[model samples]
Target: MESHPPAGGHSVRTRSQHQRRKRIVQAAAALASRGGVEAMQMRTVAERAGVALGTLYRYFPSKMDLVVAVVGEEIDLLESSIERRPPGASTPASRAVDVLMRATRGLMREPELADALIRSLIMAEVQTPFGDRMTGLLLRVSAEGLTLEQASEEQRDLAGSLASVWVQELLEMLRGRRTYDQIQRRIETAAARLLAGI
Candidate 1:
């Protein structure tokens, strides 16, 4: 079974199917929030979502795919929040750091969920739908933070680099290898260094 829907020429889900899928993702997220990825069992998610276990599998062929969907939901919320209240720093780099740190802090508040999502993201194969959607969202948010009217090749590259720095620091934080302060400082230093000239 396909882990994700086909990129194009896919059959559309009915409204009820869409709602059920939403509930499944929400259930998985709630479980992860409470106890991280380990808690998000297929049976439990199906129960909480009020869908059959078979139905759950139909939507998400593997646990990793389900976790990736949960992460996508979280990032969507972050993107909406950023849109409502754009970062307020003066320099492009500072604004980028502000956006990245805001995301970092948000995840820190829900450490278990953060761990689950970030770990799944790291484990996902490159160019998969799950990976592409999440990466695009992160880059778009980074671009907004930079206040780019139009993203030049250089600006897009910087955004990708900033996202890489953010993800690496987040992994370190989740591993207990870096404190919040350390992560912040590292991200700040990285942004400054990477965006030095531009």
Candidate 2:
């Protein structure tokens, strides 16, 4: 006899798994938005997600994992905004500035939640699968912010690299290491440097 999955078993399992994960991520995001990373209790997440406590643990082994997941979701949301620029948004350097400025404005509006998520992302090194995804999203979003007609492939790559550096610089500014105007100037300068002559 050949071994085979039962009828609809694999598809059903995959869909249910996806739904469960979505539920958990949404619940965790809601809690974090309301009270930051400190409020994201695994038991509370499990309850809110309608999954058993053990299932929540299986999905996210610790608070850090859950926090990282929440941050990843936020990054996804940020990408949408970054990609939505006006047609008049020309100049690769200026577009790069626009993307970073939008992200900065968002974090400023939600200071507490930003603090929690940024800290979690920095500290999350154990089994961190989300870091690469975050970087990839940032790169793609940065790339989208530029005008393909005006930018060469090299310029686009440089713009993406500058975008990543801008995120780290923003984190530093958030930590009170530098004044707002100083970081703004630095980001603008860096953006111009990366896409010089464009």
Candidate 3:
């Protein structure tokens, strides 16, 4: 499938344009936080952001795009937080578990928003720009947690696998197929098993 550019070919070349895009994303996030994906109508987001509907479309071509952008924003915040306070566990596996657990707890606190973001991610096409960005962010963050310095190829592979498990566990939690305790135990077990030799 041919992947569409996230902004539908629109580029932010000025501070005003950047701010406008920010507002649209912020509005979308607020709505999702409150009422999940169903509440994030494009027109409603525009009204909330105080931007024209057309302007919102220019920045985010579709509701999925907007939701993905909001998820990106959330991950960006998580990345910054991790950078400020790297996981303190001595082993790579324990540290990765710490980071994943932190992420799980944070998202669970905003169940509606987490549901919206995960739904968008699951709906995204394979190899799409949004999918790629989200995957990259997850891998990078997980790898960073594994090692504050540059991670080796083995470490990176472990991080990728652990990240995949974490996402699937989160989906199960969203579906009520797994409790929070189950999700945490599964993630911890997966991380320990995957990173056993590292």
Model 3 / residue 19 / CA error / Å: 1.5
Query: What are the Cα lDDT values of the candidates?
Result: 0.75, 0.68, 0.75
lDDT (10s digit) by residue, model 3, range 106-197: 89999999999987877875234443333344445444433423667766666667777888889989888988899889978987788776
Using TM-score as the measure, the top candidate is 1
- Candidate 3 residue spans exceeding 4 A from truth: 1-11, 126-154
Model 1 CA deviation exceeding 4 Å by range: 1-12, 126-150
Q: Each model's RMSD to truth, in Å? A: 3.7, 5.8, 4.1
Cα lDDT, model 1, residue 74: 78
Per-prediction TM-score, please? 0.84, 0.70, 0.83
Q: Once superposed on the true structure, which residue ranges of model 2 sit more than 4 Å away at CA?
A: 1-14, 126-157, 178-180
So what's the TM-score on candidate 2? 0.70
Candidate 1 clashing pairs, residues 3+ apart or interchain: none
The digit string of per-residue lDDT tens for model 1 on 1-198 reads 545552111254677767778788889999999999889899999999999888787788788888877877777787788889877676666776877788888999999999999988789763345433433544454445333335567765766677787888899999999998998898888888776655
Candidate order, lDDT descending: 1, 3, 2
Model 1: how far is 165 from its true place, Å? 1.3
Order of candidates by TM-score, top first?
1, 3, 2
